[model samples]
Structures are given as C-alpha cells and as structure tokens.
Target: MADTEEMFLRAKHRTFSGLTEGSCPSTRSCGATAERLAERLAERLTEWLTEWLAEQQAERLTERLGERQAEQLTEWLAERLAEWLAERLAEWLTERLAERLAEWLTERLAEPLRDPEEAERQWTGPFCFIQAADPQLGLMKAWRIGDAVGGGDEWEEEVALTKQAVAGVNQLRPRPRFMVLCGDLVHAMPGTEFREAQERDLKEALSGTDPSIPLVFVSGNHDLDQVPTPSTVEQYCRAWGDDYFSFWVGGVLCLVLNSQLYFNGSACPQQKEAQEAWLEAQLSRASSAEPKPKHILVFQHIPLYVKSPDEQDEYFNLPQEARQSLMERFKRAGVTAVFSGHYHRNAGGCQDGLDMVVTSAIGCQLGDDTHGVRLVAVTADAVVHRYFSLEQLGQRGVNEELRKMLQAC
Candidate 1:
C-alpha cells in the first residue's frame, strides 16, 4: 500500500501533467480520468480505514470479530470512503480548473499589440481631430423638456446639435483626420426604446460627416446603464467596436477608456481587471518601442480628478484610489494629457506635469458654458485645442434661457 505522502505526490503529478492534455487517467485505463480517480481514491480510503479498524479491534478485543461485526465494519468503511472521495475530488477539480483559467487569461492578456504598423500609419503625420462628448441625443426627451421656442421636436434638437457638431468637423480647413465621441452619445437607460431611437438619430447625424473622416465612439455611463455590466457593455460594443482601445494620430497615442469600470460603486470587477491588464500591456509596449510615441492622450467619460489630483471623491470623478493609481501609471508612461466629459462643463488643470482637460457637453447646457465640441490640432511640438459652439457651426438655435438658468445653478 502506498503511503499518504506518496499518494499525494502521485495525485499532484498527475494533475499537473494532465492539465495540458485536458484529461487525466487513473492506473492504465484511458476512460474518464475523473471517474477513475474517484474510484481509485475510494478503494484506497477503504483499505486504509479497514487496516486501522483491524489494528484497533486487535488491541481492544482479544477474540476475533464475528462475521456480522466484520460485515458491518466493511459497509461503514465503504460509505465513509465514498463521501470522502467525493469531497476530495470536487475540491481538487475546482482548484485545478481555476489554476488553468488563470494561466490562460495571463497568456491571452500578454498577447502583442495587433497591427502595430497600421496604428503607426494612422498617426504618421501632423493632423487635427475632433472630440465631441455627451451628445445625449434623447436627454431632453427623457427629461420631458418641451420643444424648443421655435417649435421643433425636443429630441430633434439634440440630433440637430450633433449634426451641427459633425458639420463643424467637416468645415475645419484641413478636415480633422478623425472624430471621437468621448461618451454618452445617447442618454437613456439600457434596453429601452428611447435608447434605440437615440442611437439611430445619432447614426443619422454622424452620416452627414465627410466620408473620409473616421469616427470612433467611447462608452459612457449614460450610454451603458448607470453601472456598466457585461450585457450593457455588449450593447455599446454592438454600436462601437470596443469601449476602450488605443489609436495613433501622427506621434500621438490616443487611449480611450471605459471609465465606468472605475466609477465608484460600479461593480464591474471582471472588466476592470481585464482593462487594467490590457492597459498595462499597451503602455509597456509603447514605452519600449524603438521610437516611442511623442505623446499619449487619453479619453474617457469621467475625469480622474476634477480640480486637482488629490481632490476628494465625488460623483463626477473617479474614486481616490483608482484615480491616484491611474495618474501614477499615466505619469510613468509620460502621458501628456487626458480629455474627458461628464461634468458637462469645461475645466482644465495640470498636475504631475500632465494636463487634464474636461470638455463641455454637446447636448445640453449644464454650466454657464454653451453647447460645443473641441477641435484638437496635433503638431510636432505642441497640441492646440479650442471649443466651438454649435451656433458657430451655423446652428442658430442656441438656448439662451437654458444657459442663464445653468449659470444661476
């Protein structure tokens, strides 16, 4: 009979070696390894228990046990062995499966960047791009805001404003190389009719843009539900390829993030873990490239910090722990700036030699600011940006009263 230590070593060896093959065998048979292991374990446990029982009986009872007593002992030992084997096998399988899963995830997460050359080509020359956020196409409709003073549909006003923003991008002297809607392209709870309608309206508005200009969408909390989940993210991804990803424009690397993953009280642990892993890999690759990108700019829905990096937690910003850790990572990777939208107002500040620019919304007037989009021009040495109001883009439906009320807030 094998000793306990030897049996354990054999089990460990079989478990480790069989992991890659997706099967384990007990003894010389090729049938279901798990079942075989269970059977073998039960047999071994019964043998061990019988031997121990016999030794105890020899010491306590000088006379040999009767046939009935021996039969009862065998039955009890078999029952105990079955229960013990069942629990042990279950625990072993769970541990092994979890280990394999973790290993596979690590390998996948470490995969090299896809199409590095393509990313380089997209950003090979100095160019400009447009960033528009929080169009919230059905926001007014959801809020029950009435039609405009000019008697237009409440929802159409949002769609028209987005169209105006797109027109603004097309009119740029050298049309922007691309346009990115940072987040909140539509405003409605997920899995709703209004959400679908808002999305269609947004697509129509974007269709008016020059075909040559590329469009990218970032997922915002509003676009997903208030708290993003796998299903909500899938809905966003059906419209946009990925909620978070990186692209290049000349020497600049633009990273768009799903900030909802880091939003306080938003329980998206799997996404948060995966994004963190993917982001680390991307940053590491960029940092080690033969000729690193000259600048790294990030876009997302929520600001990492509002007034300062050390600012206390707020609904409008990322929680403090995540904020500080992300800032450190960005600083280490030499990120030049981060552009975000959620506060619905323009704000700018610099910390740790990095700039944080939060743009105003394109759908509604939240603060004293007008509804607008920011145009960013990337040069060899500097990045220049300016805000353009919808009115500046030939949309004369500016809501002066809303602006006044916002300012009084």
Candidate 2:
C-alpha cells in the first residue's frame, strides 16, 4: 500500500512540478492523483509557453517598442496563453478522470447478478408507483437535528430505509410494479468514497426486493457538479442502469428528465433538444398505440413550484426556460402531474396545468417535517398520493429528529 501510494504521489508531483507550487498530500489518494496530473500538465504547458513568450519578447525587443509598451504586450500575450493552456488542462483532466472512472466502474458493476429480464416474468399489477427521495447513503450520521440522535455510522441506515420502502411496495398486498427515487442518493459529492458507498447501499437496498420493480431515478443537482457534463450523466446511467429513462406505468406515459438540465448552459442544448425530440416521439407513439395513455407524468429532482424559505430565491423552483419547455412538452404530451424534491420539506400543489408535488426528503427533514416516502396511486381517472413516514412505521428516533427540525423550520 505504501509503495502504491508513493507511485501515485510521484506521478502527481512529477506531472505538475512547475505550475501548482504546492505539496501533494499522501493521505488522499484521489486528490494526490488530481494534483499530480494538474502539476505535470501545467509544468509542460508553462515551459512551452515560456519558450514561445521568449521568442515573442525577443522579436519585440529587437523592434523599437518602448518599455511600457513591451511590458503590456508581454503581459497580454502571457494572459491569453495561460488562459488557453488552463482551459485545455481542465478539459484534459475532466476527460481523463471521467474515462478512467467510467471504465473502472463499469467493470466493477458488471459483477454477475440475477438478470432483470428473468425477474419480470412473475410481475403482475395494476402497476402502482412507489415515490421516495433523499436516501443519503454516506451521510446518515449528518442528519441529526438538535437533541435527537439521528446519525448512524454504518451505511445500513440508508440501505435499511430503502429496503423497508421497497418492502412496502412489495407488500402492498397487491404490490406496486414500479418505484421512483426522487433524488439525492448520496448526501455528499460523487467522489470515490461516495460512489463506493452508493454502490454498497444500492446493492443492500435492492437486495431481496422484487428485482422486477422498475426504478426510475432522476438526478438531483447534487448527483453531479453544478455544471453537469455528459460524463456525469454517463456515471449516473452506468450506476443505475437505464433507470433514468422514461417508460409507461399502467396507462400513464411517464417522462423522467434528468433535473441537472437546469444548470450548466453549455451542456443544455443537446440534452434539451434530445429530450424534446424523444418526448415528441413517445407522445406520437402513445397517441397512435392501440391503447393511448390517459395521463402523462413527469419526474424531476427539483420542484417546478415550491414555497420558498426566502421569497427572493423562490425556495422550491425550477429553471424558468427549462421549466417552461418542460411544461409545454408535458402539456403537449398530456401530462397530469410532476413529482419532485430538494426542499426536504413537503408542500406541493398545482402549478400551471400540472399538479406539482414537492416530496419530503427521506434522509432528513426540516421543522416538524416527516422522514417519509410519498406513495402515489394513479389510474385512468385520477391521481392519489400519501406520505408514508418511516417514523409512522415505528422508526421513532428518525421521526423525533425530523420533528425537532421541522419545529425549528
């Protein structure tokens, strides 16, 4: 382990020798690697740039340029050169990390498991939907509120909560054929530790539950960086399978859009266009199908409309343009309701023509709020939803903490 650690440290330090001028910490393996890569890349670019600048300076010096004029020219050239180099380095690092992580993860996740197709054989349902959010796998201990002892060291709390939620769906006596995770699977950033914890939590959570249960996962902003990239979406897709995609549940055509769509302007055009086209195709297909869906349901991470803690920011809100596009698309598709989360508190109603649901977070709650999952039953006629608190299910410790939090809120 020491030798392995040394190699990574050496790589990072050697790679970034001139640029960062900072020492690499041996403790964090991933950080060491990132630092090393950044260092070396910057060093090489800086050297090449210095040479180019020297040539430019020589050319200027040979000319009749004054001192101040030469200095300004040099400065401008250096700034533009450094900016270009930094952009390239950032892009390279992002691509390298994304590719390495994706490949490594794909191999690990490819471990043999019971086939999803095999499990589908036994499923029978009017197809009820189980709604839940904020499974906060790695941060179970961080959910404490005031005097309540809510933190658990083990990742099992998240797994247990998920299992119970799944069991609730399974034992619906009649059984719901599908389940939806509102968002926020891991409480922290999607780094190495969080990824591993998420894998373990997901495996444990889905264990022994009906493998046939179609899970629809929508990405919360936390799931990816503020400016989400294709690689971010790739990571989520690889980990969760095609759970992010849309499909039919009973007679309703459901559109599950990655809510990360709201952020990162550059990444939006393609995603927005693709989703619009996909929705159009799906809507067209549904309309021409033998049995057209009576309703359309959209699942997203942040609610389109929410009661804000602050009026200025609009607490529970969706991006205006994206939200408008979504609203129009769903309306065109005949959508009836939109399910969302991120408030960690519950308050939802109709916004525009669609009923918007601001689901309570299961990981933690604010001010007398319930740590629960919302259960929604939709039919050809109407939609009904119920909040099923884990506390009500006899998880008193969680309930107490959440109650205190809600009261404070």
TM-scores, one per candidate: 0.64, 0.59
Taking the tens digit of each residue's C-alpha lDDT, what string does model 2 give over 50-126?
A: 66875678576647687777777777777777777667765676567545644454444322112222222222233
- lDDT for predicted candidate 1 compared with the true structure: 0.68
Runs off by more than 4 Å, candidate 2: 1-127, 143-154, 284-289, 308-316, 391-409
TM-score (C-alpha) between model 2 and the true structure: 0.59
In order, candidate lDDTs are: 0.68, 0.59
Tally clashes: model 2: 11
Q: Candidate 1 at residue 126, lDDT? A: 58
Give the residue spans of candidate 1 off by over 4 A.
Answer: 1-116, 119-125, 141-154, 264-266, 394-409
